[model samples]
Target: MKRRIQINIAGRVQGVGFRPTVYRHATAAGLAGFVTNTPAGVLVEAEGEDAALAAFSALLKAQPPVQARVETFAVSDVPLRGDTAFVIAPSQGSGDLLIGIPPDLAMCSDCARDIRDTANRRHGYAFTNCTCCGPRYTIVRALPYDRAQTSMAAFTLCPACQQEYTSPADRRFDAQPNACAACGPALRLLDKQNMPVPDVADPLAAAVDLLRQGRVLALKSLGGYHLCCDATDAAAIRRLRERKHRPTKPFAVMFPSLEQIRAHCEVSPEEEAALADPSAPIVILRRRADSALPAEISPDTHDLGAFLPYTPLHLLLLDRTGPLIMTSGNQSEEPLAVDESELTQLLGTFADFALVHNRPIVRRCDDSVLKLSGGRRILIRRARGFVPGAIPLPMRGPPVLALGGDLKNVFALTRQQQAILSPHIGNLAEFASYSFLKTAVADLARLLQIKPEIVAHDLHPDYASTQFAKEFPAHTHIAVQHHHAHIVAGMVEHNLRGPVLGIALDGMGYGTDGTLWGGEVLLADLCTFHRVAHFKAARLPGGDEATRHPVRTAWSQLVAEFGDEAEAVAAEFLPALTEIERGTLRTMIQQGVRSPWTTSAGRLFDAVAALLGFQGEVTFEGEAAIHLQMLAATAPLPPYPFELVRQRDPWVISFGPTLRAIVQDLRAGTPPAAIAGRFHRTVAAALVETCAALRMRYARHEVVLTGGVMQNDFLLDLLHTGLQARGFKVHSHALVPPNDGGIALGQAAVALAKFFT
Candidate 1:
């Protein structure tokens, strides 16, 4: 019997050679079919013998293109049209936009081979790419992702390249960015003043030479520009850091191969997998003690952020230069430079020369970052290879746009049950970052063709995202509490219908009571939450200034614990402060002037780090805490004492006893490493105790751990282990970051849940 069937597939189906894959499969099965890209997804109509059609359908479901992720597939029987040949049809953009745009993929093995083969047409080509791998999200400008809707539209394909793109059997079939050296984006070398460098025949070679000569080169990459220099040269690294004004923060290193990465860092199976994954993120790996890399690459930490080349340009450069320090091409907290004008305008002072290209970047994306904990990769920064793809929501709702928090800003747009999060937009405290946020929102919304009915934002009124949400055209607006969003984001990732015991720990968020909260325990579901327990608050003597200087927070903590004796203790342990400065801080704490109380886990870590002799202001957001986590050595130290006070409805977990014990240890000459280890254990134990009690009272066993503080692998590992041992089902972030980068997803989820209710 002859039968026909039509199949509709969604999720990462566009711009990933899905139509070609379908054509090949249909032809191989001796079935007549036509495949085309639609706004909703890939649509295939096949007609043949029933057995052949069944086998073809099975193959399509079982095997998709390596870069394709099939989230939903539907097949239905259709009347036979007597089609006798398989054909790839042109894309139609009429239906609903339900398909996910493929993220930027790393260079595939075949493309790598092509670039390395001297006889290949693409040999030594910096922009060599096929359907398997190349720029996707960054170059894409509109839906029904054809070449005309992309940045590649400006570049005309040469005759030979056009043949490969038109051939259904070729690997480059329908590859939008497919090009050869004959007609493709070419690289150019420019001086610091944005003038073309004379007599540079090979820009890649010139860029490599400049890097080898200890000069900083701002090289345009797949998503944006990166400041590059030799990683092994301490002086060069120092010079680059000085020019960029990034003194102590770590710089990611790009190596040529996995073998070289293994030489400098301990690559576990999981870390190795992440480095080689298609996303090609910078994976945080443990540094080998005997390795000889320059200390300036990563100062004050035992971990190194490393990644392999994801683009042919990067591969060629790394092959010639070995390892280069690859950092974002922008001043400290500004937006990434995407085009030549922006690059020269922002990074002109830092780069000695610029390696640019003619190809435009439709959207700017930074490299994603990941760290391994409990043998799983946790996202530190989600961008590039992992974005523009939708995260499936547990329930469907009206369209919503979520503007995330100010720090580590990322926004989300929800269509039906899929939430599309924007790539990392950096700190909104900077005007440039805020502008980038707005631009990103507009671009992503247009690309997805969604005008949100509801707008969601953080409760913090002063956040740029919140302010934007206020002005955005939407039918409804909802303000989600920060900690509640953190916990709910984890819940959404795990698809949990919560009312779970939620542990939200981070730097600080505007609390419901008009205070700042971080160390909080809440019983939360998607729409609502109840704050059940929290860490006792401590005064931040100078408000925002106290966040920059850990010593101020430490002194305030001491005053809260030791009273009048706090000044003597400060004089002994905190010699970094002068007597006059100490008295002024004391008066601020006593008189309740500009001081605001916070129960932040990050502030707690900062205070302990300061007490352990880390003086002065932090160079980065979590510098002191990261250093403190690194200082903690493995030991079975007992936890410090803490008191759980049930003096009110919402109980307080007081660390006053723990502070006194830490002081006593400091007085007893205990090693800072041991104290740090003990402090971590104490925090883990207290949280476990709180959750255990809450589970008994509320009858909820599912516990979620989230927030910026959860980025600390040491603390996360302890909490994961302890909670599981106590018979609680624990969940944490893996796909999206635990930091504020994932806040938009939670905000979207909460808004949708509330609207549906």
Candidate 2:
């Protein structure tokens, strides 16, 4: 009984050796057919005995290529074509674009071995790559991912490389980026002035020597450039920080192996798995107390962002230098440098020399970042190794484009039931980052060939994303409220269509009433939400200046609690503030000059931190709060007392009692660590109590925790444990970030739901 079948497969099926795997299995099973890449996915037509065909299908299901993810597989019987042998067919460009674009992958073990073997032809080759691992999203210029459509199109394959590429059994067969030293892109060493370094026998070795000498090198990577320096050299790390103008923010360190990482950071099983996963993201881990790494790498925190080498260039450099600080090559708050011009313009003063390659990066992507909270891996930044892969929507909807919030921006495009989020686009406040956002939106839309019917953006009218949405051509435009989007983002991740009790906590979001909102509780579904409960509001004196200097916010909190006595309390707790500064701040609070009220849990953390002896303005977002968390980690104190004023429609969780207790503790000479721990415990307790009450009133046992403040692992763990103990289902972010980076997904989901409604 000879028969034929046509199989259509979707997902990450192209540019990952899927065709070769199919060819080998079909030949082994004695089937005659062809496998070709199509706009929709991979299509295979096989003609053979029923038994052989069944075996082939089973093998494909059981053993897909290492990097291939089969999301959908359909097989149907077709009339037999009496072909003599199996063959790989050319890709088809017409049809619906449904296939997943492969993200940039880390170097595979086989490729690593090939680059290290002395006798291997690819030995010491900086651009060595195979089907399993190499640049994908960054180099791809168009779809039906063939070599001719990629950055590799410029490099004509040499004879030996072409033989391997044409051989069906070879791993390099049809691999778009497949190349050897003779034909592939090569590296070049240049000075700060962009002139080539002459007489360099081995560029990689010279680069390593420069690192050992504590010189900063701007090195091109799979996605973008990284400014590199030896991690152990305090002077070098300090110099790099000074040159880059990044004073206090932690830097990601790339180690040669997991063994090296284990020596400096406390690697749990979950953290170890994430560090070695195929995506190879930078995993945040707690540094060991006895670690010998220089403090300049990560200041004011116990955690270190560490990762294994994801590229041969990084591997080669780290093999000689034990560890290197691999921070993004960009000026402060700008997008990552992706080309020579960008490198020189952004990192010219910072980098002593540039180690660059001839291959052009079609797109710029930063490294993805992750951390474990309550044994669940959470994405801090989604890019590079984990982007351009679609996340399944709860239901199908029309194509929609969502422009995310202004900070930690990431955009999303919806196709039927799938949502494709763009890689991390830095703060949209900077001109370079904003330009990158526009470019990324256009690039992703063109690649997916999606013409969005609806455009979604944040409710903030002043955001660049919102402004762009106003001008983007679409049939419909939606304005999604900031906190509402945060809650819905968590619901989308969990595939929930519920009126869940949502706790949205962050620094600031424009409220519906034109005030600032952050600590909010809402009864929300996909489309709409009702304000249920919220934190008591406090005046933010000096507007944005109060955020930069937490002491001003602390003074405002004191005034809210003790009125005129706040000045005397400020003298005792905030000695850093001068008497004149205090008098001026009082006038600001009294006259409501440049002051706005906010219900922000983030601002509360800053106030408490200031009261606990933290001084001076913060250098980065969440710096004061992060310092408080570090202090809290050292103590295990019970929660301070809090009050829930339930007389209003939307009840208020007041921190007046808690603030008074914190002041009393300071007066009693209690350790700052104890006060910090108590403050954290108080916040967790108040949130749990509010949720339990809301669950009883609304009969909704499901609770969602989201927002940038939820990134605090310590608070998340407590909230999760407390809610679960009270017999409620608790959901937190795992797939996408809980910060504004994940806002686009929520915006898209809400817009689609509203469209159907």
Candidate 3:
């Protein structure tokens, strides 16, 4: 009797060697089956003895490609016509299998073996790849993940590759990225204007040599561009800094391997595991004092963000005996260059040469960010290795699009509780950024087959992303408050339904009551959040200007404390406002030209940084705050002081005492380093006291500390230690950044909580 079974399998079935693996198993079991890709998933009709059929099915469920994920399976009887031998057929391209585009994978064992093997056809091949590993989402243009639908379409498979691709028994039987030296994407070394450098056999080696000799090379990478230079060369690094106009904010480093990175930084077991994961994201680990990288690479920073190679090209480039400063190749505050036109224009002055490639990157995703928390390593920005992929939501519901915040902006599209946040798209202000966001979102929607009915965005109207969301006329627009989104984001990442005390601090956000809020203590659930506590609101002379210029913020604080009529104001302000033109400072605060009130911890850190004279002028966002914490280098933390004042019968953290003590220390000529240490310690202590007091009232020790300000290592370390000593379980971002960039996930989570449970 001829027997047949129809099997439907779903989940990361595309671009991950799935069909080939299954075909190989079925054919070896002597089952006659035809496999085809449908929009919903893979569909197969197999006819064989019950025993062989069962065995093939078992192997499929138990062992498939390592990178592939199987979410569900359905099996049913189907009438069989006498069919001989299993055969993998062409994709049927039916059904909307919306869920399973594979995330870009790191180099697999097979590819790694080939890289290290001198006799292998792909020996030392920079673009070597297999079905199980290599760029998937980054290289993909359209769906079905066929070679014709990818950036690799330009390179036709050679005779050997074609044979292997056509044979079910071959490892690359269904590999879409299958290519050899004779046929595949090849690397090209380009001169200053992106002209191909003629006659170079090992361009990677030559590029490394140029870098070792102190020349900057702008290398096109798996995602976008990277500004590469020897990490150990300070002069070379400084030259990069001058060229890129980036004076701090700690650049990311790319180590050759996990072992080398571990030797440079103290990697926890979890961090090591994440580093070795296929994604190979940039994981922030505590820096070892003896690390070989120059101090300027991460000046005044305690932890160094590092990663191993995700691409074979990176592996080939890093085969040398050292790490490279793999910083983003762009001028400050611009999106990374992906197109050749932009490369020549944006990175023109920065790099002397451009490593070019013919492959087209339809979308650009930066390498993901990561951190270790509570003995676990988790993703911060889920990109490169983890985009176009969906996070499981708590409940199933209608589709929604969440346009996240302005800084580090990433958006999400949701179907049910599952939200697929696009990989870090960028600031959302630049024209290129807006276009990237629009195109990537549309691609994700097309792949997932989702049509959003509700659109979520931050409350600020000026946000470029928010404005973009309004263009979606069909969706019901919903504006999520900045801190509310922050709190809900913490709740979503922690998988909590009950209310939790969330401390959402950042540079600035519009409060519901029409004032600026940064330092906020909120008792929040996914549904709503109550403003429970906050930092004292101080005057700012021109709101945005005050943030960029911290001296004005510090001076405004003094004016708030002593009023404009008070005497000795100059002497008191002079200690913190060193080098600020005194006449102009007093006039701005008194006349209130740009003076508005703000209660932002991020701004407070800026003011403290300015007061310590670490930085009076900020060229970029977060510069002042970054330098302020760096001043804590070796300063012994002094006694931190703060008072809980009743503002309209609600508790508020008063910076008056904090400011007074800082002034007293400055008048006495205390070391700026000590002042920085004291201020950080003081703020951390205040947070502990405030949150603990709230904890006593609410009976919840689980406090979530989020927002961009928490990225400050000094503040994070102090707050984590202070709160732990005081007996509170603290939760910070691990799965997502604690910054505005991660706001979309929270918005989706919050919206789902309302729409679902």
Candidate 4:
């Protein structure tokens, strides 16, 4: 008997060769059907033998394209029509935009083969791609993800390329970026002054030669420009660092192959998988003790950020040169350079020459960074191949947009039951980053055709993201507490309904009591949070300057612990401070002027780092903490003592005793590594004790660990074990970062729950 059915499928369906897959499946099954793209999803109608039709339906679900992720599929029976042949019909652009477009994928293996195959027409082509892989999110400017709606529209397909694109059976069918070297975006070699290198014959080869000669080259990449230099050359690395004003923060490296990277760093199977994945993020891998890479690549860190070449241009360049320092093409804390003219102007001082391409980048995205935690990839910076993808919400609500915290800024826009997070927009402290945030958010909203009804932002009024949220006239404007957002983001990532005991630990967040909070234990759900217990507050003298100089934080902590006697301790322990600076800080701490108290886990780490003589001043945001974690002893140590002062309902875990013990250890000639390890253990113990007590009182066994402090692998691993052993189902971030970079997800989730409930 003949049978007919209509199917509507959604989620990561468009631009992923779904219709072509369906067409081939139906034809193979001997079913007459038509498949077309609708705004909601892919729509298919089939009429054939009932057995064949059932098989076709199963194939649609089971044999989807590798890149496609089917979220929702619906099927309904219909009266059979007298259709005799299978056909891929024209798309119907009638319904409102509903489905998510897929992020850009790294170049596929087939394309790589073609690029390397001498007999292939696209031999040595830098932009060779098929339907399987190529630029998607970066080049896309509008919806329906067709070639006409992308940056590739400017470059009309050549005759031969057009034939492959039009052929339904070809791999390049409907491949928006399909192009041969003869009629594709062209590459050029330009000097720092933006003039073409007159003597250069082959631009890529010249760029490679320049890199080998220790000259920095700013190469235009898939999403933005990357300032490249020979990673093995210490002089070149030092020069690049000086030019960019980046002193000690680790720079990411791009090796040609997995074997090459494995030679320098220890790559576990999980880390190797992430490095080779299509998203192609910079995976943080532990360095081999006997490795020979230049120390300047990753100073004061045990791990090296490494990734394989994702683009053909990168592969071509790597084929010519060894590992290159593939850092973002921008000054420290600035937005990454995207436009050719703007990049040339900004990177003039940083690079000797520019290896640029003519293809326009519709949206600027930095490469994502990942680290393995408990054998799972944890996103440190979610960008590039991961951006603009929808994260399913726990519940549906009115459209809401969340402007994340100022640091590690990322925003989210919710539609239906999914929240689409924008790529990592770095610290909003810089005007350029703030501007990029605005433009990127606006572009995403426009491209996705969404106008949010509710706007969510941090409670901190001083945050640039909060100020941006104030400008949204159409939104309801809800202020979510910073640490609450951190905890909730973890819950949202795990898809857990909370009322969980959330341990929010980070550098700084605006507390509900008009103070800064980073070490917080909260009874939290999606809609609200209650501060149950917290670390003892310490003064932050000189405001933001305290973060740069850990010595100031140490003095403040000492003063809070030992009164006037702190002046002597400061003089003896903190030799990095000038006598006058010490005197001024003591007076500030005593007078409590321009000194805000913070119960920050980050500040405690900073104080311990300073007292142990690790680093008094840091070049990056979490340098001291990172170095402290790096210097810990391999074996476990007995934790330092901490006082749980329950003088009030919301108790305080006083680190005064711990600080004093650390000072005693410093004087008693204890090894820095031992002290560091003990300090870490002490912190983990305090948090575990707090959560165990909370579970006993509240009877909630679900414990969520989140915030920037959770980025420390030692602390996270310890906490994970301790909580689970105590019969608690511990949840921490896996998909997104535990840092402020992922707070936007929590903000969006909270806003949705608040508005709808």
Stretch of 10 with least lDDT, candidate 4:
93-102
Q: Please provide, for model 3 over 218-265, each residue's C-alpha lDDT reduced to its tens digit, 9 standing for 90 to 100.
A: 888877888888888999989998888777767788988788897899
TM-score winner: 1
Kindly report which residue stretches of model 3 are placed more than 4 angstroms away from their true locations once superposed: 1-98, 373-380, 562-580, 631-639, 647-649, 665-678, 695-702, 717-730, 751-757
Q: Name the top lDDT candidate.
A: 1
Between candidates 1 and 3, the one scoring higher on lDDT is: 1
> Looking at candidate 4, what is the lDDT of residue 373?
73
Q: Where is the poorest 10-residue window by lDDT in model 3?
A: 565-574
Model 1 lDDT tens row, 122-182: 9999998888789988998887677998999988999999998999978899798998788
List the pairs of residues colliding in candidate 1.
none
Query: lDDT (CA) for every model shown?
Result: 0.90, 0.89, 0.78, 0.87
| Ranking 1 against 4 by lDDT, winner | 1
Clash counts per candidate, in order, are 0, 0, 11, 0
**Per-model TM values vs. the true structure:** 0.95, 0.94, 0.86, 0.94
Give residue 512's lDDT in candidate 2 (0 to 100).
87
